[model samples]
Target: MGIEYKRRYALLLAARDSEYVKKVYGGYFNVFVAAYGDEEEEERWDMYRVVDGEFPDMDDLQSYDGFIVSGSPYDAYGDDNWILELCFLLQALDSMQKKVLGICFGHQVLCRALGGKVGKSDSGWDIGPRKVNIVNSCSLFETLFETLPALTIIECHQDEVLELPIGAEVIGFSDKTGVEMFRIGNHILGVQGHPEYSKDILNNLIDRLLSQDSIEIDQANEARSKLEIQEPNSKCWQEICKAFLKGLWNEYPSIEQ
Candidate 1:
């Protein structure tokens, strides 16, 4: 389905507009998916080989200008062999100062890889377009819409970042979930919300999760209700994308323009 590809491509296009860089997908997805999303090769990527649960080679990671760790359906604290391997890979990538961006489960992986703790949250599930309060200034928040009410983003996750990775800056947060977002370094960022999700994409995702039994039946419907599904806030996304892009390039200005 184009649902998954559309969300992924949103991030890809954002990176494309912000200067120029070659991208590589470092998650687990089939190669055929690359041709399914878009026609522009440079405007898209096929990044599934990074964690194929087989023999993941990091050689491709080195050639890319930056990397994105896409969201996954698995829980980070679960008893899975691939989770540990992915954590190790993230840690190694961090050492190289790779400009890494992790979404949802990927964010949890960054936390675990860098000595942060992640497990089942007492809050159960954080779903819908909840408010993520800003705590401190970071690259992800530059030129962001902080003045316009709360940043209600599409968030879906059971495991939250309970601990901050070594020297990680606490950025935006939500009252519902304390650690909604954070940053480990100048180049590494983790977002708990789905800024990449359009309203339709998010609604469809809820349906898929319910059908596949990945999430509880009751919770999926409730999550959909909270999505806010209103105006298309491409500006909010610009704040996030530009911040991440500048952070990746280490181009933090004295004042956010």
Candidate 2:
């Protein structure tokens, strides 16, 4: 073999490791690792609970090959100290041309950090499995476009990217959300859905949302019903995300390649 190399990735966890997540998925970190990590490879992911004010040091930023921002219960537009700090961190990552992937709250926050507008959706809350139509605008991901015309992903968010950042472009959309996915050149990408979520996790979350009065009984039931029949293309999404993070622009190439 010529050489052995491994790419390091960090998960900027924006939510607390909930009791439910821990009980069901062995913690939120496990959930993300299960979704995006190569289990056979021991040296891959790092976790930082940013919601708890934990973050990777600035000097160590160059060590990671890419970063992933997890969904949060908190508003991305809020002026909390940690949120501000995370925004500054994101700006620095962008400047360094380091790859960053944002999911849900991460998506909205990245937009906010990079000169975009985000707010509560005028169309209201979008919960459960949603089908996102990939747009053909971004030529940079032609292979991804060719592979997946549309993808169904687990969505649970009220905030959205209303106006894209200075150089961001919408690459995916859904009926409920205008900006389902966006890209900033090749280094940054944001997705408004939880490709990491499993049906059981979403079901548990639905129950919690119902108890908290965040979603109506009918809406929750409808979302569950759809999940009974439709499966989100988690595999395809994993490929796309891994490709972007690994700096593969060809055809959603595998990480090992």
What are the lDDT figures for the candidates, one per model? Answer: 0.60, 0.88
List ranges where model 2 is wrong by over 4 Å.
1-5, 40-42, 253-257
- lDDT string, candidate 2, 1-257, tens digits: 64343778899999987679888778998988778777655446889989989999999999898999999989999999999999999999999999999999999999999999999999888887889998876788875575566788989898999999988899999988999999999999999999898898888889988999989999998889989998888777876787788777665543221
Q: Which 10 consecutive residues of model 1 have the lowest summed lDDT?
A: 12-21
Cα RMSD for predicted model 2: 3.1
lDDT, residue 174, model 1:
81
In candidate 2 the C-alpha lDDT for residue 26 amounts to: 81
Error of 2 at 120 (Å): 0.6
**lDDT of candidate 1 over 1-257, digit per residue (tens):** 44332223212111111111122232123211231233442334434433346423677556444456666667766557767777777787788886667777777778888989888889787766776676645544453433434566777777888888788987778887777778876677787876665565566667766777778978876776565554434346435544464342244333232
